[model samples]
Target: MTPDDERFDAKTTVLIETVGHHVQEEETDWFPKVRDALGRKELQEIGARMRDVRATAPHRPEHPGSLRAADALLG
Candidate 1:
């Protein structure tokens, strides 16, 4: 591969690994702590509220901040 292609592959690997780690940490660590703190009844209520919000929420983010962050990282 060309140097540019190799650089892109490395960057993609880092981005994917970072996202995977964040998801794993959030699910395996943070979510359990939140569940323990909030309990099931509260979580169920929150889940219902979340479902309602998700039904109406825009599929894409409304804010440009996320794009800016990604650009800052990748550009």
Candidate 2:
């Protein structure tokens, strides 16, 4: 099986919902223009950016006041 299948486990329903939302974003704001304009290299760059964001995503909820108190607690 693929890594995506393993990462998004049965209990992680929210991840599926989040992917649906991202698909909607692409449909509304990106796919039409991108389908015509962007090349494979540009698409690769976008994928790389998304990977970087996922790698450094915030794991813990940040409190309102402190800037550094509740930073990304992820590994």
Clashes of each: 0, 0
Per-candidate TM-score against the hidden true structure:
0.63, 0.38
State the lDDT of candidate 1 residue by residue for 17-62, as single tens digits.
9999999999999999998899889889877876765555546675
Q: Return the TM-score for candidate 2, rounded to 2 decimals.
A: 0.38
TM-score of 1: 0.63
Scored against the true structure, residue 42 in model 1 reaches a CA lDDT of 88
The lDDT leader among the candidates is 1
True-vs-predicted CA distance for residue 32, candidate 1, Å: 1.5
Clashing pairs in 2: none
**Candidate No. with top TM-score:** 1
